[model samples]
Target: MTNTHLPKPEARRQLLLQLLKQHKQLSIHEMTRQMGCSEATVRRDLDLLEQTGEIFRTAGGARYDDPLRGISFHEKEQLFWKEKEAIAAKAASLVQQGDIIGLTGGTTTFLIARALKDRHEITVVTNAVNIAMELAESKKIQVVLTGGVMSNETFELSGPLAEAKLDGLHINKMFIGIDGIHHQNGISTHSELEARMTSIMMSRADRAIAVFDGSKANKSSIFHISPISSLEAIVCNTPLPAELQEACARDNVTLHIADGEPDAL
Candidate 1:
């Protein structure tokens, strides 16, 4: 490909990261061929990404390094993008003016925050650094960021410090993102810290809602957050299994199915 045909620097770098994420590890030759760029350009992109700690430089290539067992936030953002957006929109529709809402870290909740950006007279309580930053510029929404150690993979603040902050606040509603939702295990996540923190947040909220895509249904992760009975409702892209549906009904938990369409920005 010629120079004029090349993507801009930032776009090219983002594409390179996506490529690396999809292929895991790729040599210089492979990346150059895949990216349709010269070897020198691919090398420079790899060097910059490595410097930013986005990838690990190998002998003649780079590999995506995801230290956390769960999928990284960037990777998760790409998976079920439309479904997540739809779930977020459905969750946001439940918000009311002057209501204090809690948001846990995940692509779905992040999109929920975006969906609420233009609304007025609402407050957002969150443990996600990126969500906090996303709402910082909103003139109408009040943001409360909990203090704790931020995870590189999830951008979520957890530990004692974050839990302590939640003690004083009362949330009208909370939209939690979890790795799995099962009939028996209820809801769970990969990180124990996240599970603990999310549980605490749920306790403080009057209504706790789980927001996820279709893939999370009938799945259980390593760390358990709470049982299915604890949730007020669940919003997802597809209908849940019969067992889960029966569980939700027995527990009086409401279920909402999103159309998986893009929310109007």
Candidate 2:
């Protein structure tokens, strides 16, 4: 026994990681029975995986991380331009003139900024470098950049500084971009700091809107930012679930399903 003194939890965790890497997903019940461990132990191990961003926790199992590793602004914009714009359009309609809006980082929020060019008297606050750069040209709206540490991969600013800057402002509406949105997991992002600021922004705003396409729904991500119930609206494409619609109605959150066209909607 080269390492006989090693703790059982450590050995079981390593084994669990190996199985997860091999299968790309593993259920709690299966892992518990196979590892000869308690249910609580298996759950704790899976929770560790979730914290490390190695896997996304689900109802009874975990899903594999994104194949490409992480998301980038250019890649996200290229990946789902139409759906993002449609979702953004729906989100934009929820904002009235003279509103103070808090927009999140990432391409989806950038699309919302682009869609709001014609809207008047709106003061936009954000930590997205790209969105700030884009909105800088808008004479109709005031763009406030929350100063903070920036993520080179996504080109978004997130950190203690951003959070501090955001704490000073109150907004009428907030639009956030989530990595995944499961009915159980709610809103999640890969970056912990991004999640923190997003949660703060939601709390600071009068109305919170989560904007993402259908691809984001029915999925969970590594870092959970906030619950779905916190938002006042969920904007997405068509074919939404009846259960989700009922849930939103019960939450008093408007669920906008934008198929296409401005007048048709």
Candidate 3:
């Protein structure tokens, strides 16, 4: 007897885990189609996985999660490709030749590092493994690494050691990446160690520039990095919320909106 009923809950969840790992993310519709089940069934499966902390749900889909696999840097690099690139371009254009800058870790800042690859005689201090390595091969730029415990998920250095390394250093500009930005709650990132490092970067820079996409606006994350008053300028692909625009104006923060394709991934 060949019974083609839906797989049992345990089997279904295991299958879901494999799907999330294989794709990094999966939407309810896609999962439903793949499993030959209704959307309701897929939702229940996702809910179960999320309860166990095996997945994290975003607005449209679920992201794979575990001790080894957190919010992925690789996934973020491809999430808002054009928007992040545009924001990076705008941020790069703001940098003057020979300026000493600080960059925190994030996919957007990684793009900023790429955008500044050819700039001459610039010194960049960073705690991000990927960003430092990206600029390591450059002849025109000098890269400084903040040695500390590395976060496998983010590929960045953090902790008290990284904070101490920035103690006596000053920057002409600091470009920051945020997991959340709000009109009142301010800028934040998911990890507390990263948030602490970000706050230090803001304090040591003469000008603090925030680089992010539209998706992060009006949201709050687990850890607060800095207040709205810390920003010198903000570069993003979408328009800021009206309240945020007003707040920026009051705080004397310049906002630059770049145009790009909408979020597809």
Candidate 4:
């Protein structure tokens, strides 16, 4: 039997997605029973999940549709959004005028781009098309976009062309967003090409900081970017685990925790 405790709307939808993944498909009655919610609530959740392209609605049920690449940018933008905004605010506070900043692609870093949009005399060097577009109209902030094929999943430019562009330029700071961060394996992402591009960005920057929410803590993805010791600092919404905290301290990595309430930038 499923747990009787009710979850919030977001939590319930996530749980429903997990159930669909395990069963592949599920009838309304089954979901209503397993989720301990009314049939109407189950249907509503299915509709919302379907709209995100994460599931397919059948006549009386739903089926999980695993994304061909990874989660869509639109979908990722919805998850942990407030936390990401808070983290972005904390990151933006570190930027100084005239700083040439490097940004990697992900929802958090995208928010960082948005946070820095109104700043003056700063140049944003990025591989994410979405980020460059976000800062494009800001007359005070110059935007530099790299050249390469873009990833449909991430909208990040990578490969030989992107690497060549970075060879001549330097960044005052680089804020990277990753799929996972582990104390042992360091920071990582799902795509190797994105990882390679992120490493190059790190190498070009005077300071490299990893920005992520608490859920990413202690998790490790498939492609390794750089070790934890390489980071100058980490900005996250929640406190990291003890082991990871110890690792950060040992490596002299500064950990900046953004408060729970997101600040308006």
Which numbered prediction scores highest in TM-score against the true structure? 4
- Candidate 3's displacement at residue 152, Å, is 0.8
Could you tell me which residue pairs clash in candidate 1? none
- The residue pairs found clashing in candidate 3 are none
Error at 95, model 1, angstroms: 0.5
lDDT of candidate 2 at residue 116, scale 0 to 100: 89
| Count of clashes, each model | 0, 0, 0, 0
Order of candidate numbers by TM-score, starting with the best: 4, 3, 1, 2
Please write out the lDDT profile of model 4 over residues 223-259, one tens digit for every residue: 8999999999999999998989999999999888887
Off by over 4 Å in 2: 1-68, 260-265
Q: List the residue pairs that clash in candidate 4.
A: none
Model 2: per-residue Cα lDDT over 1-265, one tens digit each: 2335778777777778777777866678877877788989888887776655556665577655663466667656665678778878877877787889989888888889998877788999988888888888788999998888988777778787888887768988889988877666678887777788888888889888888877566566767888778987878886555666666677776677776444211
- Judge candidate 2 against the unseen true structure and give its global Cα lDDT, from 0 to 1: 0.77
In candidate 2, what residue range of length 10 has the lowest lDDT sum? Answer: 256-265
- Cα deviation of 111, candidate 3, in Å: 0.6
The local distance difference test score of model 4 is: 0.87
TM-score of each: 0.73, 0.72, 0.76, 0.77
User: Mind giving the per-residue lDDT tens digits that candidate 1 earns over 56-136?
Assistant: 666578777543555689977766788888888888888889999999999999999999999999999999999999999
Q: Which regions of candidate 3 are displaced past 4 Å? A: 1-25, 28-69, 260-265
Clashing pairs in 2: none
**Between 2 and 3, whose lDDT is larger?**
3
Question: Which model, 1 or 3, shows the larger TM-score?
Answer: 3
Question: In model 1, what is the error at residue 90, expressed in angstroms?
Answer: 0.7
